[model samples]
Target: MAPWGSAGKTTPRFLGQFSHYLFRYATWLPVLIAFNSYVAQVTWIRGPSMYPFLNPQYNESLRKDLCLVSKWSPHRNLERGMIVVFRSPENPHVTVVKRIVALEGDVVRTKPPYPYEHAKVDVGHVWVEGDGDKTKDSNYYGPVSTGLITGRITHILTPLDRAGRVRWWEHAEREGVQKAQAS
Candidate 1:
């Protein structure tokens, strides 16, 4: 009997397959994990919050927008009009995407559902809002700490017609918020 298996010269079939699986995964898993954690990630944007831009439609055909979220920006200062994905303050377990409407030290006249008529963004925090109304965002939760930000949406990669680079202040002219992102 061979030391590697049953009363035979060959290694067990299950053992060989298991080793191969481990070898394949062990060799690439760490690299994949690092790349996703520090570089960028692709995600499907769901819901109508950023309407006509991300997940445009709500009915059948239901084709959601696929986006590239750049993880590199969270360490730097974020500016107004940039779309961002962050941990929901109301529920840390969930993440939501919204645009920065007011930055720290900036004052904004907020709309209803947001208890106050005006809000001054405190240091280390920023005001965010969805392009679409009725979204559950800072307008509802108030300013969120910059520490909660996870990544910035840098591009839309799907639905061919809408695929392109997403500039920081591309939607600034759409209203509710109008400050252009500084270069």
Candidate 2:
């Protein structure tokens, strides 16, 4: 039999190796968690709510667009045409991604059944809409609290051919102009 503290023991060697890895992982786990929670993370985009900006074409395989979401941006810095990810006010468990159409105190046009053709965004609230005309958004659920916003999408990461920085502002501006002309 080997001595009590001898290096010839396989059990102690295995235990020591396991403990080293455990300690190393434990030390890094919190940092990883913090980064994922407050810095940035990858999010998968599904459905046609974002349409051409995201899931442009309908695929039977249900492949989704992958995006890098920045969690550190302040709400005050968010612009009218920026894309954002937020928790659905109607269902806390669901998350929705949409474009910011109006900020607090801004007047926005509304669709039917809202009692008013134009509505003013309330203080601390924002108006969000999907790129697709048929998408359900503020027009259906009304203005959402800015607090509901979780992050801003910074890049499209999927479909290697389509990977690039997200720049939809020009399109949004053109859409606004067209809407203005149509009205």
Candidate 3:
């Protein structure tokens, strides 16, 4: 015991307890980081690019769609009409969500201003388009590399009335392509 009734003894004990507590939980840090980085994540969608199927209203009072994006889904197996979140090819820092319009080796009809009347998705890439024709997408940037795709959106988690697995039936119908089943 010291003059202050064990004041000298308290500091070491407090530090030891803190070190032990930190050691016990430090092991979970990597797992938590990996889960968020490679497993699944919740994302807030904020734009008119997806429209009717996603954010249908322009009013700020209406909540935006919150979606569950699965990083584990293999981009190579992506089919036409599946919505995916990918890093913009023109600007790697920005992420864009779009529907897979065509897979590798598939022929895609191009819209105005694109040099070719039709374009074939090159190897290791896929053609993506917005649900709305007015949105900027493959029609503007062309086919995007698969490596830029980060995740496949599986479910809408917010706005209870609209919450459910995201389906591409309408988009497929509009594109004249077969709708893909949710994976």
For candidate 1, the per-residue lDDT at 14 reads 82
- State the C-alpha lDDT per candidate: 0.80, 0.78, 0.78
- Write the residue-wise lDDT of candidate 3 on 84-154 in tens digits: 99999889899889888877777777887678888877888888887764578988898999999999898
Candidate 2 lDDT by residue in tens digits, 1-183 = 223333345568877667666776788989988887688989898888887778877555677889999889547576778899999989989989999887777777776646777878888888888887668888888999999898889899997789989885765342321122211
lDDT of 1 by residue, 75-170 (tens): 486877889999999999988999888878777788788898888788788898888864888778999999999899999999888789997765
For all predictions, the C-alpha RMSD in Å is 4.4, 5.8, 6.1
Segments of candidate 1 deviating more than 4 angstroms: 1-10, 173-183
| Best-to-worst ranking by TM-score | 1, 2, 3
Candidate 1 structure, TM-score to reference: 0.84
lDDT of 2 at 27: 81
Residue range with the least summed lDDT across 10 consecutive positions in model 2 = 174-183
lDDT of candidate 1 at residue 161, scale 0 to 100:
86
- Residue 64 local lDDT, model 3: 85
Worst 10 residues of 1 by lDDT: 174-183
What is the lDDT for 3 in model 3? Answer: 31
Candidate achieving the largest lDDT: 1
